[model samples]
Target: MGRINGENRDVVFEELWKLKIPAKSSVFAWRLIKDRLPKKLNLRRGQVVVNGTLCPFCSNNEEEAAHLFFNCSKILPLWWESLSWINIVIELPQNPRDHFLQHGNGNVGGIKSTRWKCW
Candidate 1:
């Protein structure tokens, strides 16, 4: 018995060479992105909705990622103040995974803090 070539492995590899994501962190990230509850609640398709519709913070139809992260009255000011303190401007990603991954990095302490505050 030997390994076969051209196998479509859907499982994520533990080591990605230079990416160096911790195993727990990688699993948590995947769960955040792949979980079905958010999709069902948000009415997104295949956990990959990108019509720039529906707010991530609130379930409003017109609320895109940008609005949710930087324009919505409920979350905008808090995020703005946090970014101002850090002196960085992150362009919100259309995909929830990208947005979460980018901010999940240790450098974005403010973002992490804000997430906690929200929860």
Candidate 2:
């Protein structure tokens, strides 16, 4: 998807669509990059009643995309382990789009790069 207001397409989105992933996975990434997932905070903002906004895993703060995927104590380790398996040792970006872009743009080449991006 391009800009909602008819501006130039975002590079992140352009790169996102080129990934050799399933359509559903690509759509999920698009929603994640746009911060449009129906996480608790987003649901509340959309006027959908939520019992509690706290993250289901940690319950330490309002459930938002950033916290759920990046900052959550329970989930962050999984990210680390996944990265480590691929020999990546860099600090993770806090924003989901940044994280995706970083992982998708690894220094490897061709199939390896695509595989890392997919991974």
Task: List TM-scores for all candidates, in order.
Answer: 0.37, 0.87
What's the lDDT for candidate 2?
Answer: 0.82
lDDT of each: 0.50, 0.82
Worst window of 10 by summed lDDT in candidate 2: 103-112
Give the per-residue lDDT digits (tens) of candidate 1, residues 1-119. 13345365332221211134566655555554454234333545557645565565676646544454445667867867777876667665555445555554554446453352222
Query: What lDDT would candidate 1 get against the real structure?
Result: 0.50
TM-score of candidate 1 on Cα atoms, chains taken together: 0.37
Model 2 lDDT per residue over 46-101, tens place: 99999999999998988989889888999989988987887778887888888877
After TM-score superposition, the amount by which residue 45's alpha carbon in candidate 2 deviates from its true location, in angstroms, is 0.9
Sliding window of 10 residues with minimal summed lDDT for model 1 = 9-18
Alpha carbon deviation, residue 37, candidate 2 (Å): 0.6
RMSD of each: 8.7, 2.7
